[model samples]
Each structure stands twice: as C-alpha cells, then as structure tokens.
Target: MQDVADQARTSKTTAHYVLTGQDQKLRIAEETRRRVLRAATELRYRPNLMAKGLRTQVTRSIAFISDTVATEAYAGNLVYGAIAAAAEHGYLLFVCETGGDPELEASLIGDLASRHVDAYVYASLFTREVQIPAELHFERTVLLNCLAADNSSPAVIPDERQAGRDAACALLDRGHRRAIWLVGEPGEQVLAGAQRTEGIRQALSDAGTELAGTVDCKWWPEPAYEQFGAFLDDGGDPSAVICLNDRVALGVYQALKARGRSIPTDVSVVSFDDSDLAAWLQPPLSSIALPHRQMAAEAIRLLMTDGALAEHPVHVAMPVRLRESIGPPRS
Candidate 1:
C-alpha cells in the first residue's frame, strides 16, 4: 500500500480508496484514480482479502459440498457451472467432497465455516431425496439435482415429469399407441424414474390410450439387454419402446438387433438422459436431456440472491434431443 501510494505520488488514504473501489463514492478525481491503478499494476500489488474480510465480514467466497459429484468426470459440469457463476460475481469457489461419509462431511463443513465462506451449494450427482445437513440449515445454501427430504431448503433439479411427458408425446405424435411399451422399471430409490413414469402415464392417458405393458428391467445396459431379450423370445413385438435412460436404450437396441429387428422400421425407440451414448447408437437415439449445467447455474443464481430463495424446488426444463431413432409406427 505504501509503495503504491509513493509511486503514484498520492496519499495512502487515496490509494486505499482507489484500490477498494471507494474512490467513486468519495468523488475522487479520475486522474488520481488512474494514477493509483497504474502504480498498483507496476508494483504488482495484491490486496489481502483475508485481512479485509476480518474487518468487513465479507469473504466473497462460496463452498460447494457434495458426495461424489466432484469425482465423476461427466458430473463435473455441476462444479463448472457453479464456478462460472461465482466468478461472474467476483467470488471464488471451494469444492469439497465427502464420498458419502457423514464424519467427513461434518469436518468439511466445520472447516468451511472457520474460513467464513459466504454461502453453500449442496449437490448430488443423481436426482433423489436428500436430507439437508443440519449444519447448512440456517446458512445461505442451495440444493442441486436433489430434493430436500424436509422441504426446508431451496433446490434446483431437472423437470423429470415434464421430460417424460415430452418423450411419450414424441412417440404418440408419430402414431404409436397400444403397442408402445416402457423398457425400464421405476425403482423406489431414484425419484426421477418414478416422476418420469408418472409423466408418461399422464401423457398416454390424455391421448385416450395406455401402455401395452412395461418390460421390467434394472436401469442399466446389461439388465436391459437380458430382460428385453427374454421379452422378445417370449413373443413380445412392440412398435415402439420408451427406455428410462440412454444406457437402457443401448441394451434395447442390441436386443432388437439380435432378433433381426431394425430401428424405426420394426420398432422405434426413445429414451431419457441424452448422454453421449445416445448420439453414438446405430441410428442416433432421441432422448430427453438431463439439463445438469442449467440446474447448477440456477442453484448458484438462487444462492447469490440478496433475499431469501423460495423453499420450493426450482425446476429447469429438460430439452428433447431429436434424432433418427424415432419414426412413424409400423403395423
């Protein structure tokens, strides 16, 4: 500070005001402000944010706490989106992972609190019901890709039900009705699966039709392949299949192929989670995107709001990525 003031030929108070962005409020001359900034640059002066935070109680930093989001390659989008939003507001982010260990999570929370972090973003890779940590209950915190079990915290998640409705409507519009079957079971642990299934049912009901039947299988490639293969061997011939996710779609595709069936020609297939695999499939799969990045951005937006965020979860709309997999149903 003294070096900059001396180099700029200005008083230390003037240098302080300029560096802290208080010169404008004080009506300092533009020329003097320019000189202080130039001197700062030449001297390579860096302010001690921690010292300043001690006096102002504003650290201008946020903490992102999660179970496995930081470790997953694709799920890293959540951290990236939060970092971008925080940078736009001139704040830095601290990403911490607990690996689903409660003790580690508590320790991380305590350390962040000691550092005077301004806010928190609690995140999960999979959409499901979560219990908000008691440590974050009163803090400015936002939940990402998960709902609060107590419904007491602000949350951001993809609109699974709406995405399901859109997925079904896409097939129904192509003239598929009675012979359309769902390819995955809605497991109890995953909230997204059940919500999406409900949305599909609602859309089918609105069309004055219903599902022919559901081929129960775990939401994975291997399970999907085995069960769908079994279904085919049992004389199941469907016009279209709605896979719960892209992984399941892959299995369904392979099963259909083994039985000498062609996509859209013999059976149209649509799915959720427009993951990279969706595009790489033989005849690119049509799917509803998860909107991970958008959900993270919305979570940060709500966290940074001046006023309190609404307790109700914020729903980011899912987008339909259309491709060659869907077509008019054949007899």
Candidate 2:
C-alpha cells in the first residue's frame, strides 16, 4: 500500500481506498483512482488476507463435515447444493468426509475450529438419527439430512411422511382402490420407510380404501422379483402398487411385464427416491422427489440466521415429479 501511494504521489489512505474499491465513498477523482490502480498493478500489490481476517474477526469460510457424501452417487447432490449456496453468500466451503469414523470427525472439527471457520455443517447422505460430537458444543453448527437425538442443533431433512402420502394419493387419484405396498425387510426401523408406510396407510384410510397387503423384499431387486412373481402366480390382484423405492419398482415392472401386464393400463405404479432409473424406464416412472437440494439450501440458510442454534429442526417438503407411468385404473 505504501509503495502504491508513493508511486501515485497520493496519501496512503487514498491509495488504500482506491485499491479496495471503496474510493467512491471518499469522493476521489476518477483520474486519481486510475493512478493508484496503475501503481498497484505495476507493483503487483496484494492484500494479506490472513491479516485482514484477523483484524475483522471473520474468515468467511465454512466447514462441511459429511459421512460418505463424497463417495456416494445418490447423495452427492447435497454437497453440490451446499457449495453453490455458500459461494452465493460470498463464503467458501471446506468439505471433509469422515467416512463415519468418530475419532476422525472429532479431530477434523478441532482443526477447522483452529483455522477460524465461521460455522460448520454436519451432513449425512441418508436421513437418520445422529449423535453430534461433544466438540461441536457452543459452536455455530447445523445438521443436514439427519437429526440430533437431543436437538442440540438445528437440522434440515426431507418430509418423508408427506412424500409417502403424496405417492399414495397419486395412485388413489387415478381411481385405483386395490393396491399393494412392496417394502424392505420387516424388522429394520428406518425412519424414511416407516414414515412412508404411515403416509400410505393414512391416505388409504381417508379415501375409504384398503391396502391389499405388504410384501417384504429385503429391499433387493431379486427378492422383489421373486416375491412379486409368486404373488402374481398365486392370483393376487391389485390395481396399483406403491414401491418403497425405485429399485423395488424395477423388479415389480419386470414381473408385470413377464405376465403381459401393461403399466397404468393394467397396474399403475408410484414410488419414492425418484432416482435416475425412474426416468429411464420404458415408460417413465412417476415418483416422489427426495428434495436433496432444497434441504441443503435450507441448512445453509438456517446457519446464517440469527439465533439459528436455538431454532427447532426444519423439515422440508419433498415434491412429486409426474411422468408417463400413472393413469386411471382399468375398466
């Protein structure tokens, strides 16, 4: 700054204002501003960011701590969304994947805190209950796609129950009364699966309709194929099917095709997750979206808000993407 001021024959304050783009506030003449900039360019002058950060008490950076998001294909959108939102707010994101290791996570948090990051976002690939690290206490942090058991921090997750309700109602709206729900194995307690089932049941009950039955496929395409094929052989009849996810729906489609059943014309289908396969199917599959982007954006917004640590967890709504698969029941 001193070198630039001497070269331009101006006061240090005037040179500082010109170089920082604050010269408009000082009402400096345009010719003087040009001189300061020319001198700065000639001297290759650059502001020391670390010194500036220390003086301002802000680093303008955030830490994004995640579990498997860096490797998993389906949940990668969460990280992308967070990065884009952080850039929009003039902040940088430092992403670190813990691979579900508790000790590594603790160490990473400690290191980031030492670097003076403004805040932290702990994200999970899948929505589930999480135990926040003790190291995060008293820090500005937000949880994405997961919940803290003690509600220690504000969390943003998809509305699984509403997604389920939307899926069921999509089938019901097509005048289909008889339907079956193909689900994962019975004993596992996944919050998304349970909430979806509840949504389906509620919608059925409200419409004075009954679910024909539920088939547990262990959440695998092979089991789904075998189970659904046998059910068809046993003369099971349903006008619609609610698949727990897109992979199970794929198996259901295979079984129906082998029996010469046409989608929507014979049995309408609606599913969850809205994975890429949904749109790639012969006739595109209509399913509920997971809202990964929305949840991530909301997580960043929550972190930026005042008193965000005291606010309750927010559940974002999952939207339905309509495609070619659904229609009115057969006559």
Candidate 3:
C-alpha cells in the first residue's frame, strides 16, 4: 500500500482507502478525487485486491454501469436497493454511466477492471444487444433491469413483455376496443420498443381487437406531441391510447388538452413506468409499476457471490399499477 501511494503521488490515507475499501466521500470535492485518481494511474501501480482479499476472500467493491441513470423513473429507489444490499454484505459500490453508448460501455468497464473491481453490474434503459468485450470478462458480472442476446448468463430484468400485455388488458377490461399506440422509436439496437409493442399486439389479438393507429415517439414530449397531434389532426379516431412510458404519456396528455379532449372520456390513456410524476399527473395516470429496487437488490446479490448463480436464471415480474387514467370508451 505504501509503495502504491508513493508511486501514485497520493496521500497515504487516499491510497489506503483505494486499497482497503474505505472511501465514503459523500461530500468530497470532485477535483481532489480526480487528483488522487490521476496520481494512482501515473504510477502504473496495481493494487493487489486478490492478496488483500485472500483470507477474507472478498474485496467488497461492485462496479455498476448504467446506460442512462438520469432518465430512469425509479433511479433513486434502485440505487437505494443496491446500496442496501451491498451494505448487508460489507461491500461498496462504484457507479459509471454510459449514456446509452454501447462502445463507451466497453471502455468504462475496461477502466474499472484495471482497479481490480471485485465484480460488475450493467444496467440498461431498455433491453438490447450488448457487445461485451472479451478483454472485459469478469468472474462475476450481472446484467440488471435488462438482457442481452447471450441469455445463458445470469441477468435481472423486469417482465416487461408481460407488463405490456397487462397494461393493454387493463384498458380492455375498462371497455376500450379501438386503441392508439404511441410507441418509442426503435433504434438500430434497442429492442424494448419492438418487444413491448409485440406484447400489446398479442393482448389485442387475444381479445379479437387491434390497434387503431401507431405513432413512433422517442424519449421526448415535444416529438410525441407533434407526431400524435398530426395523427389526431388527420382525423385518426381511437377511444384509448397506450404510451410507451411515462415521458410519452406526458406528451399525450398535452396533445389531448391542446385539441380540447378530456382523458378517460374522449380518450383514455395508459402508460408504462409508473414514475413519481405518474401519480402527480392531472387525475393521475394509470401505469405499470416496475420492480426497480427489487431488481437492483437481486443483481447486487448475484454479483457479490462470485457469479455463482444457479443454473436456471431468475425472472421476476412486477405487478400492474392501475390509477385513475382509464375509463369506458365514449358512449
């Protein structure tokens, strides 16, 4: 530890924290943290986490990478769960954000690996194909709240497909036949839109119903409002609408209000991701409640046990959350 500290040009305290797992800087200045990290890198000093953890057999550091931490509806709860789980096992957490960039994910993982992070956890905003770099393989790494093509490995994701179907079914139960779907833009790699939309379609098929129209709305309100507004202006008629997520739902509400339409009477609305704002919406919005905290805790648990998950994967489905948004179609 002393050698590493000298080589890294960092204080002995900082070096010890870097090696012995004792840095809890809830209020440390960012520049001071950066300086310590830079010195440690310049020294080309590698902390032997294996040796330090040989007897204890656990270094207690889990690195988490997220596609978009800021946009998540339940990000705070997810972090709380992860932190609580880690604390239970005397472990710590280091977080990184990829901002939905796959290439950057590989790079960030590589950097964390150099620190000899004990394990890894990757969280994606939506399900998609992940290009895991061979150089970034770890003894324990779990995908949280998402999945990849390589489903052989352990992953923790919400049963979004079921959630979508249930959302549709809820609307159907309220006497809605014709429905509009405001879907998210299907990117080249993101699979959430396609899978979720298929689930909604399946529900409609089972009920001998179909969508009145479809509108592709990305993760913004203005675009969703514009796209949906055009469809409404074009005389498109639907008694109910299902939004991709809470974001899209907000836009749908605005568009309807702009056109002098009332919700649950002129046009019932249902959305996924029952975010904090969902309940705050006018009359509240009916949505699917994602198991964000539960999923996060489960992922940390799996990652901490040296990747020794059972042969079968664990998939937990969150329940549907009905609010005041849906009602019978216009009489």
Candidate 4:
C-alpha cells in the first residue's frame, strides 16, 4: 500500500479506495484514479483477497450446489452459466454436486458456509417443486429449475406453460386444424408436466378446439413407443402429434415408421427439449427448448442484487427451435 501511494504521489487512503474500486464512491479525482491504477499495474501488486475477505466480511465468491445438475447434459448449462456470470461480476464460483444424496449435500453446504461463501445457486436436474434444505442459509440461497415447497425463497425456472402453448401454436399456425393428439400423459406429481398440459389445453380451447386424444405413457422412449404404436394399431389418426419431450418423440417416430407413416407427409410431429437428438433425426424435429443457461444466470444475478426477490417466481422464456419435423397437415 505504501509503495503504491508513493509511486502515484497519493495518500494510502486514496490508493486504498482506488485499488478496491471505491474511488468514484469517495469522489476521488479521475487523474488520481488513473495514477493509482497505473502504479498498481507497474508494481504488480495483487490484493490479498483472503485477508480482504476477513476485513470486509465478504469473500466475493459464490457456491453452486446441485443434485445431479452437472451430470445431465442439458442441465450442465446451468453450471456453465453460473460460472461465466460469477466471473463477469468479479466473483469466484465453487461447484459441488451431491448426486441426490442428502447427507453429502448437507456436508458440502456446511463446508462452504465455513469458508464464508457469499451466495448460493442451488439447482436440480429437472424442474420440480422441492423443499429447500435446512442446511442451506436461506436468505443467501437461490433455487434454480425448481420451486420452494413453502414458496419462501426466490426461484428461477423455465416458462414451461408458455413453451407448451408455443409448441401447439407451431402446428396451428401451419394450418393444421385436424385432430391433434398429445402423445404422453402428464403425471399429477410432476409440476412441469401438469403446467405444460394446462397450457396445451388453453391454446386449443382458445382456438375453439381441444386435443383429439392422448396416449398414456411414461416419459421414456420405450413406453411412449408401446403406447403410441398401440394407438396406431387401433386406427388412431392424428393431423399433428405433440410429444411431451424429445425422448418420447423418438419412440413416436419409430412407431410411425414401423406403421409406414411418414412425418409431415403423413403426420406432423413436434416435441420438447431441443437436445442434440432432435436435430440428428432424419427430419430434424421442432422442439421447445428449456432455458437452462438463462435461468442459471438469472439466479446468480438475483442473489447478488438487493431487494430483487419478488412474490412471483422468475420465469425464463423457452425458445422454440423449429425444424423439418412439423409442417402443414397431410392432404
């Protein structure tokens, strides 16, 4: 500190403010700020962040705690966004995964708390309602891709209902007024599934129509294949099929092919999750993409800002990636 002050011809107080990015707040002159910065650069003086953290009681670091979020391919985007945003805010980020183990999650949170982590972005691999753990320091934590059971903490999640509405509109806009079947039945326990189902119904109802039918099946490909293939065997004909997800869409595609039905030419298909498989299909699939990266970044930003938490949860917009799978209804 003394060396920097001497080089810049300024007092230790002025040098301190400038070095710590508080010069403007203290009304320090522009030229003096420049001199202090130049002196800092020349002296190769790096602030001891550990010591500073003790003095200011802020480490300028964040912890990203998750249950299998880092392991899932799409959910990993949350970690990437949090790390990138933390760096941009001049904060370090520590990532820890619990793999859905409760004991490990509690232990990791305890370890991070001891180090005085300034904030937390707690995430989940799937969008669902969850109870925030008692181990987490509530006020300093933000939930990602999940909602608090008590609705006590601020949260960020994708707008799945809007995504569903948009997905249905994709077919409707293409002049497909014929029968539209939903390929997967949403379970009551799954919040995302139920919300998407509501939106799908709303869109159709608003259009003076409704779903022609639905095939009850699990979200996985195999179950969807069996159920949809049976629907076909029973003489089910759909102008457009709205699959619950890309995985379900895969099974639907296989079943349709086995039955000698061509996509778009015979049946238009649309699904969710614009994952890699969506594009790789013979006719690239149109899908509603979950905004994982955006939601993660928003969670970090919300934690950093004061009085930003509102009663309403932040719903990040999902983007529709339209491809060749959806087209006008067959003649």
lDDT of 4 by residue, 99-185 (tens): 888999889999888788888888988888887889773548889999988888888999989988998899889987769999886
- Writing each residue's lDDT as its tens digit, candidate 3 over 1-331 gives 5765676566787766754445664343456556656766777768766677665656768887887853565566666678788888887888788886767877887777766778877776665556554554545777776665666457887776788798889888988877555455644454656656777889998999887767876767888888888888988666888888888888888988999999877888998878886898996999987787888899887765642665445566867888888989898
Q: Is candidate 1 or candidate 3 better by lDDT?
A: 1
Off by over 4 Å in 3: 1-51, 54-57, 70-74, 98-115, 179-183, 186-189, 304-307, 310-313
From the highest TM-score down, the ranking of the candidates is 1, 2, 4, 3
> Candidate 3 local accuracy as lDDT?
0.75
TM-score for candidate 2, residues paired by index: 0.89
| Per-residue lDDT of model 1, residues 1-331, tens digit only | 9999999999999999999999978798999999999999999999998888888878999999999999997687888988898898898999999999999999999999988899999999889889988899888999999889888888999999999999999999888887889999886677988999999999999999988889989889999999999999999989999999999999999999999999989999999988889999989999999888788888888877888789788999999998999889786
Model 2: per-residue lDDT, tens digit, 1-331?
A: 8999999999999998998889989999999999999999999999976677778878888899999997788888898889988988888999999999999999999999878888889999877889999888878989999889887778898888888788888987778776555445533377788888888888888999767888777666788888988888989777888888888888888989999999978888888889898999978999898888778888787778776464577878888988888989888
How high a TM-score does candidate 1 get?
A: 0.94
Write down the lDDT of every candidate, Cα atoms only.
0.91, 0.85, 0.75, 0.88
Candidate 2: residue pairs that collide = none
Which residue runs of candidate 1 sit more than 4 Å off their true CA positions?
9-11, 24-35
lDDT of candidate 1? Answer: 0.91
